[model samples]
Target: METTFVGRHVEIAQVARLMRESRLVTLTGLGGVGKSRLAHRVVEESVAEFPDGLWLVELACLTDPHLLPETVADVMGLADQPARRRAEVLAEWLGPRRSLLVLDTCEHLVEAVASLVDTLLRAAPRLRVLVTGRQPLGAPGEHVYSVPPLPVEDAVALLRERAGLAAPPDGSGGEGGAAELAELCQGLDRIPLAIELAAVQLRTLPPTVLLRRLNDRYHLLTGDGGPVRHGSLRAAMGWSHELCTPAERLLWARLSVFASGFDLEAAEYVCAGGPLPAGQVLEALTGLADKSLLQREEHPTGVRLRMLDTVREFGAEWLSRLGEDSAVRGRHRDHYLRLARRCATEWPGRQVEWYGRIRAERRNLRKVFELCLADPQWSRAGLDLAGTLWFLWVCCGMSREGRHHLETALRADPGPGPERLRALWVCAWVAALQGDLAAARERLDQCRAEDPEGSVTGHVLQVEGMLALLRRDHARAVELLEEAMAWHMAKGGVLSGLLPCHALAALGLLAAGRPAEAVETLSEGQALCEVHGEEWSRAQMEYVFAWAGHVEGEASGALRHARSALASALGFEDLSLSAACVEMIAWAVTEEGDAGGGAWLLGVAQAVRDSLGLPRSGSGIFAPVREQTLTQAVKVLGGAGFDTLFAEGQGSDLGIAVKYALGEKIS
Candidate 1:
């Protein structure tokens, strides 16, 4: 690591102070504006403060986001690193080390990098993060310093020095153009990578001519030096792309489907479509990363991978050239469609896997939903995705996203035949989950009004019952549940799946105050889930059991089952289940005479609720659970306490649940 830096003197001092004041210091700037160089200097200069040697995790060569934490662990020489999770290992390793960790070029892998940074900051008191990227990581307590490009005079001087060229002649001739060229460099976003690229054209082309060419031929004007080492920003991406093998190229082309971020499993599942094998995606991804085409980073629970804007642009061009955009996107839609259908079929059972898969595919899947709604031919695909993700919105805790897409698709084609009716029911379910009983009623009324004798009437009724329970309409909820239950029996057990059963249990157990019967109903649901191989559904059953036990004075039993539910929720990345279980734990803590513990749990639930952007309907699971937990907690502690839990959970757009019970807003 070199302690010497050419520019960014102010940036260095500011960043150093931020690091001293905060554990996490993020350095964001346009690419190649000496971010990496500046970071290297800071670590080298600050290296003596850290008794433990500085650890550098160069994201430039890491393609598989899942491998990021493990890569860091390897650099730190830690053994027995788990393949499935590396962040945990990293946090444990850094827990005691007083060291500087430089995370370079993390813009592409923003989500994963944010997660890892968060965990390390939480677990390691003495460890400091020096991150460089195109944007601030948006982590808590992160002091961000945006590094600008070199000044014009400095830029000209640096260009002359690097290109080994003479200063332009005074005035007249092309001299004025030289000054104009320097100005043009600043307009190119003051990005050092862009400036260095512009300097390369000086050797072969006059300044004015080169500037004129830059507008139309960004690729040509971007290069300097020899053809082999073009050294232009565009050339850098091109160079990286060219080094990829055919399989890697194919994967890279397909990866353009993602508008935001994605994970390895998603890449393998969607990008592989006969071009690359699942077994080799990790390796091909590695190849792309080695070429600087893809970047990998670690999230708290998983990995998120991304491509630079310039690199992604190159990939988009390549994808267009291949004429495979539509084909690949269709494949992307189909894969997620199949997944949505499968997960919907298995919902409320294997809650952990459900949330995990949703969390992994949420970003790309949202794009797929857009494509489906945009094209009539793909509208059913959109409906399928929206319909299947309904559980994700309601039970799994993704109602905000679910409602957004569902409403979009429904508006695109609002007709209530059977499929449309199902969509309506799903839409209603989302509204109900959000505690917007009014909205749920409105959608339901529209469904009934449009199709009085539709085939999906039974499904509509089932949702009606579920919403009734959600709104504490125990009597109406029970009647609706029974009616839908009889209809399911009449139809040979069709729509009487998890939601209906869960609705019945919720009504019978909570609203009706029959904890024993609710326990029995939940037990039956669990057995059915196991028989049907619905792990996510079974987790929901466990959550019900926990809820019932909490109400029945069996705090120990409730805690044990809630833990199981949470484990399953994590496995599935089911936000709803995680939130539900957290709420349940809070309730149990209150029941167990641990008001302080209960408040903490409520705080976490609030954070989860806010992060998922769960609507504040004052009736949804979170609100009801939060209210009940707080009410009981007040009883246990003689008051709800002076702290407001909901206010503490608002950390940022990332929406990390700060605490489980209190629902404190995070600033």
Candidate 2:
């Protein structure tokens, strides 16, 4: 999708012309000067010339320069080949393909990106590289374009567009409005970002009032003999910062602690303190947004506020100068810590909402985890946070990230404790998902040893049961799961472990070929989930119920449960669950005498799995069902017919696949 670009036609045309004339075009500008936006505009305009496609690799979040080549390869969908260097793999993949590669935010990793780009440009003659940064990549034959701030007229146009305000009525004697806007834009150096920030204030403040405040602040700061930094974006930002009330400034600085955007409640929880009272947080937040320090975004879940990187950096500097860095960070960690715990606690009944909330806070959660692991005193907190998000990571197909955070926390805080014990089991769950049985076993053993008789023992047992199932020890898995379920139920509270216990126990029964018992078990679990409004675990249980119904030769019953499972899975965007549901639906359709439909859905399921980089073995419990379904569909449809239907399914997108699974005919 193309991002909305305003007031960059001239720059776009120039950059596009430069791109066609040279294989390398670098857009250089100061922070927040719209270099990235210009590059994006140029790429969009010139994309038709490159039939191979255009790929954007964002380096803002990437800190390790060593992974530059791998990051590029991953973005290009080029998997690593055994014994082949990543750069070599990338070059070979790009060779013979005419493509445009955009390397964004390269100032921090300029050397590494420059070297990689140089190599690729030499190896792949048809490749074009467009880069955005504060400086040039310095590669040979690099055409550098210095992007400037918007012209006064264009800046005013952009301000009006972004602020949702129309230009003052042409001849209504509202010329004053135009003059004020021009002055505000000039005050902000005609920088697109700064002008937009100032313009948003039109929602809450009159343009005249905003202009007055800016002038007052500028006059106060630029006293006699001070060389005016009118063209400095930082100076404009600082002036805007100075106009904020003390509470607004404090909130702005504290809000910098977040790695991504956050909502009002998070701001209140993290930024409220001695000077900034919690009661005033809402007002202060609105004030900051009006001043353009915070960007207000409307999301499906709720409205969120974000600080631009440059604004956030300025806030960080102020925070450091205020000497409240450590304390504010502590509050930041505590807030996300509480957030993680709440998500875990509420996940049983509010699974969909919790999933969205947690996804939104992922960047902040990562920041908190880093803060916890980096400080000796906060390592335990970090471990606790990581342990709390086990379900999000494991069930949501983020096992790799989950494992990385868990291992890092465990290494930093290996001391024996309840937190450490919890971290171990969570780590075990993630490791098992990755098919690392040995690591799973070791972590489970460590967890068991640390909390043999505590509340966490039930969780430990559940992990062990899951590992047993993975190893195909049906009886042992059944025994462990039953024991864990009973223990949690006896404890009488709504234990988070209960849901997993139910899931694994049902899977164990199915594995043992006791389809009826498995169906009954999962049915009860599903009933309980409905009572609690827990969609995540219920989705998985429904899939199991579908599988059990298939085993019992009840095609209609299996199809019903599979459809229910798919609705929940797609709602949560859980790819693994969706894949499993698709497979079960395919089997049920085959049993219902639609061999072509079954083959098509099987192809869709395989596509979903491949998109996630999951191996066929990743669907451990459902592998037999998938295999049987494929064999039967082939037998009924014949090889040629099956291949054509399967290809049709493979070519379908998620929306089409879902429609087909739900019994809609695909044209």
Ten-residue segment with the worst summed lDDT in candidate 2?
A: 77-86
Candidate 2: deviation at residue 469, Å?
Answer: 2.4
Best by TM-score: 2
Runs in model 2 lying further than 4 Å from the true structure: 1-5, 16-26, 39-131, 135-146, 151-190, 195-231, 452-455, 492-495, 664-667
In the range 94-201, model 2's lDDT, one tens digit per residue, is: 666688999988998999999999888988899999999989999998999999989888888887777777667772234337777787788777887777666555
With a 3 Å backbone cut-off (N, CA, C), the pairs that clash in candidate 2 are none
The lDDT leader among the candidates is 2
Deviation (Å) of 10 in candidate 1: 5.1
Q: Model 1, range 548-602, lDDT digits (tens) per residue?
A: 7766768888888887878766654566567778777877777777776677666
The number of residue pairs in model 2 that clash at the backbone is 0
Model 1 misplacement above 4 A: 1-10, 14-231, 241-254, 260-287, 296-306, 321-325, 342-351, 489-500, 513-516, 546-667
lDDT, model 2: 0.78
